[model samples]
Target: MERLVDYLAPRGPLDWVLKTALFIAAINGLNLTVEFAMNGALSMSLLAHVQTTSMVAFPFTLFALSIIRHQHRLQGQLKHLATTDMLTGLPNRRELLRRLGEERRSFGAFILLDIDHFKRINDRHGHAVGDTCLVRCAAHLSGSVGPGDVVARYGGEEFAVLARTRDPAALEALTTRLCEPFTCTVAVEGLTVPMTLSAGVVRADADLGYAELLRDADAALYHAKDTGRNRAVFAPGRPAA
Candidate 1:
């Protein structure tokens, strides 16, 4: 019974229509049976009344179903807007923080990646090209990161990746993979230009707060940018080699 209610609850108008139909049918059938038992004949007027009630119920049922479907669609769209980056289609900062809180206990690594000289690109090529670079960088990060990794846009050209693996080697390798030059063909003056990225990786431990992890990664990223662009830096406390 509970399962039936659960199923019917979601159906909204369709369920109402079905219940109304069944109710009208039951009442009409019962009335006809009583009439035949009492007067030895069934009445056509009783059947007509049931049909009229069914006709009246149809429009209300359809309206209810339409409302439910519209609500379901709206909820889906709202969820997407809340969680997804509008520019790059990656998970946004809010979703990233939510994942960090949820997976901090289980994950061992947090990486913060930023596009090196992103402002230069925007200044030289325009915001349209800058947006293209961001989108391409997001794709590269998504592809380079391992399965079950949480990748998110941390605002502007910066991105965050949370990985669960305990192996520092694996994390470093992933960082190296992301730093490789990305070639995006931007339509600038009827010509195309390429892009590159730099990344910083930090290992998460019980001693570190999520903010501290981000800071560490940001520090490494700053180092990477300061020394040279298109490089990966691992946070201190990992081996020098």
Candidate 2:
């Protein structure tokens, strides 16, 4: 039943029209089969009947297609809302984790970072400016990564990056690029907000389990924060390469 409904609900106008035509042909064929069984003969009147039935069904088919298209669009919007962070337009944690599970064996490294003094910014400048700063910073971080890499909003004031390459030097360079944008003060709503990031990096080459690797990266992040913020730290358990 669900499959039939899905097949009838085509996603585009051309598909809807094609499917409707095929359905009408099937119905006309069934009618001809029954008429032949009863009278043991085919007639030209069948053609007129088929044409009239098709014309009668056309407007109703078009109406149903419109409703189906609208439902498809609404489903897409709801899926986007579920997987995306509304504030920064980045993938939310659920989406990130889902992607990570798919790419765990293939991904080169995982990076986790967060604003150094985000709470202070929110307290001093109010939530509005802090939100503006977050939006700007998310854009900056997104621009620093390669096309294949994934950057997502991990949680409040925190971001995660799934690096695509296994090269240690490239990973280091990416970390620097991620932080470079915040070296200067960001102006949001006539307020100057100084921002910096402390990141933890973990290479997946060591054959560590996904959960363990995340923990190592988190530990390294705290290590950076403990020593001093604004620097990126590679997990001690994971080698540079």
Give the best candidate by lDDT: 2
Indicate which candidate wins on TM-score.
Answer: 2
lDDT of 2 by residue, 123-205 (tens): 98788888888897888899999879989999999999999988889989998888663632445356567788888898888
Give the residue spans of candidate 2 off by over 4 A: 1-13, 26-44, 181-188, 237-241
Residue lDDT tens for model 1, 164-220:
777867776777787878777766556465767777777786478878887888888
Q: Rate the local accuracy (lDDT) of all candidates.
A: 0.75, 0.82
Q: How close is every model to the real structure, measured as TM-score? A: 0.72, 0.85
* TM value for model 2: 0.85
Error of 1 at 196 (Å): 2.5
RMSD list, candidates in order:
6.6, 3.1
**Candidate 1 ranges beyond 4 A from true positions:** 1-62, 237-241
Error of 2 at 239 (Å): 10
lDDT of 1: 0.75
